[model samples]
Target: MSSPLKRSLSTTGRSISPPPLQRKIPRLTEHVSSTREPSVDQLRIFSWNVNGVGPLLQKQLSFSADSLSPLRTFLKRHHWPQFLCLQEVKISSKDTATQRRLQAAANQSAAGDEPSYTIEFSLPRDKYNATGFGGKVHGVATLIRDDFGSRLRATRRPDWDLEGRVLVHELDMGLVVINGYWVNGTSNPYRDPETGQVVGTRHDHKLRFHQWMLDEALRLERSGLHVILIGDMNIARARIDGHPNLRTSPVQHVKNRADFNAKFFTYENGLSAVDVFRHKHGNRQKYTYHPRGRNWGESCDRVDLIVVSRSLVDPLDAVAETDILDNALDRGHSDHVPLWVALDMSIFSAKAAQSGSD
Candidate 1:
């Protein structure tokens, strides 16, 4: 069999200057679509924790005068992906300035024409509700190439979705893709104000997020939809996934790791999906997140991931390629590097054909 095709951009001796913070953010209107159609047999999906869209857009505009839109520049930098998933967008629906900026950036073409991407946003609502991140801290967005996006529909649960942490979309082809920014439990133990009792609000949220995600995936599976789950899971997941190994001494941290293993990775009773990237790379020490102010490689974790249901596993050798984009680190785009997976479209298309024949 042929080797898995590598489409990652080279990160060799090239230098990209740090974007000037003072540069005036350029206004970008519509232009010709920068994205091209993928091979009929292949589909590509990309995910990144942009840190924040507002700042990322400014950096993109600073790169070149010709940059028409953030999506355009982004697609050009990496070969265009059919689906682009972003986390930690940090834009709230109430923040009109940033909201408008994001809208402008996403609409990368003439106003009268169809935009290149069909964008979906899970933004924090305007108020500080218990279920939300107070309209600022966390958000997620997904941009599907218009053709596929047009054929998709949203799936949501009020509690899991209100914080703008989860965005689920189902395609007409019986596939569901979940883009998530799982809760990162607090660094310190929490205490109730009045009673002074330990109350792990953030930690509880993290566990709930995991359970919710597992339930959603299972539900989709029972409905006969294949699932592709992607984004910053916030858990380094294993000793091998982190430099110097991640701390498991904390009871909460240990619980978190165990929970993830049981619900998602365990063979006997878990979701039984494959962490496709890891399956392909097989113990390679590459990482996706390097905490700010920390030394790269020396202090990092591979928290970003791409996972797919069991049905998709057999096609891996012939149809899939996964990569952690090191070049994104060179550009200083965000603390998290872009992670991508390419799958042959024929896998899905064949299933569709079979169903029709049945």
Candidate 2:
């Protein structure tokens, strides 16, 4: 296999100044006319576990200004939703240059005109202490088209926001979009040296985090706002989600499988969400993550996902166009491919107007 793209931002040893924020928020009602009837507008939303943002932007910059890189090409192709949610960005708060580079890249337009998107990052606080690639901080980031930024109100949950795991944004259309990166619970079991009995494990923490996400989703639903939950959930919902040939220890496999099923499919009190992609394409055997050369009996799985509440499911389903960017895989950009969906935004606009009139 060809070498993956380099992961360093300052490999050339040149000090670069941070780029100024250039996003301009427009008026929320500009897109809607008072006399015109609300019509369905195709809104495309894309999600990816970028693994790291610095290296990804470095790869994009390697291309000449006249030429489009894979990253740029992917972003430019889908013109519908214009909103993006990214996970496992692995960027730290202190890395201002890298952050600016990412912001510029995401906002850049193909026509060399003013940027179309505004960017926000929920990066980890301490680069030196976080656990990941070389103790680098990893968190989630979001990008919204500049037109929608005027209607967007973003806040981090007081209890869950500090760790850079969740970002909540409410649009003036009465819709809420959440971007999240759940903890990967893969640590080895801790055992007592003398008795050889398993003492503890990180698996429990992972399960608890999953529970927290579910509870938060429910809370948002009760508040009467339409919700779109998208991110790298890090849990395979069923046996079909993973490669059949890959094998884990029997005990470990059973516990993880059970947890994933209950969290995603078990509906409590008639409140449950639907996985948009899976609902549209059932048992298709598509995997989002392909492990690179480290096979302990695991090769591929579908960990990344996009799910929406039941209230919005019918409308989303009517106009949903979902796909995994298979061609972008193995290009050394990331282990996971991008998953995207296009939905009709007219539904939300109509609902918002009706509520306002009441």
Candidate 3:
């Protein structure tokens, strides 16, 4: 079955026509910024599922030329310092126009100021094309501030990177930030002929992806690098992570819930990861995604997450706070809200030194 979301461009090799610019929403006019500047010792990282960058760019055009683009506006307001991981960008790397638009937006700054960010992208190609959404399938992207971008030594896992699901950047600080867009489980399923069980669904693929991430996390940890994994994981860990009213098959939901729990709670070699937001907020009923239809009765889930290794949690918790950016006014941008954490890098001063020496 095809996805419910529409593609921005057609598969017939036609150029995309820009959507009509609508009047700027009142919320867009508000000027907001973080309470503090991101010093060399601190880094503010953010992640969001854009749904589709092509459509988002079109929306940005509707605003006044002097105003900041939607993405930049969000970054500035939240005071995102150095790193941004965007999932479901929905544009191929071959699409130079869209890629350039992202670059321009990342570099965009106040008048007479220089651009701040340099970007890297992972695009899906060939058999790895997870999204069958015509020629306009989605991908993931990582944008680093120019200052930090210069320190990026290399990208690990070339084979995985080609799937456009993961981008692991190896920083000179011996830190690795992985931006991932895990596969959304298949919607349709078939029953087994002999056992009479539902099988061959997308959830199977999602399970494999989760296992791969677990392995990757361990490998990175063993290499002695501080790791930050963030993106739209597309899995709700428990009943609290998702609205209870959403319709789902009992077996599928149960399996998915267990898979999510294992991914975060299970330990390998005595090491496990923690969900930053959940750790900070506890049992907060906040959600990062509000599915189609504005009806409150519909199901919503906190699938977008920021997970960090246990080693970094202590330092992060010392000086940082995490929250779900669920502004109702910004709901028009995408179904998924942005999730972020602000950390004073100074807390990591000791750990940074230790990692550097390794």
**All predictions: root-mean-square deviation over Cα?**
8.6, 10.3, 6.7
Candidate order (TM-score): 3, 1, 2
Query: How big is the positional error of residue 105 in model 3, measured in Å on the Cα after superposition?
Result: 2.4
How accurate locally, in lDDT, is each candidate? 0.67, 0.60, 0.65
Local error of candidate 3 at residue 326 (angstroms): 1.1
lDDT of 2 by residue, 1-358 (tens): 0112211212211111111122111122334222122234766778887666655463444434544433454455455246788877766666778777777676544565533666777876432224344434447888887766787866564364444777787876657778887755544453333455666654654576667777777787788777778888776677787775433443554566567566656746434777877887887877777543444224566778888777777653433567665432221355676787776777766776887899
How would you encode candidate 1's per-residue C-alpha lDDT over 194-298 as one tens digit per residue? 455666656776787788889889988999888889998977778898776675655677787788878998946679888887788898888887654455565
Off by over 4 Å in 1: 1-38, 63-65, 107-115, 126-134, 155-158, 187-199, 315-319, 328-331
Best by TM-score: 3
Q: For model 2, give the 10-residue run with minimal summed lDDT.
A: 12-21
Per-candidate TM equals 0.79, 0.76, 0.80
Q: Rank the candidates by lDDT, best first.
A: 1, 3, 2
Model 3 lowest lDDT segment of ten: 6-15
Shift in Å, residue 11, candidate 2: 34
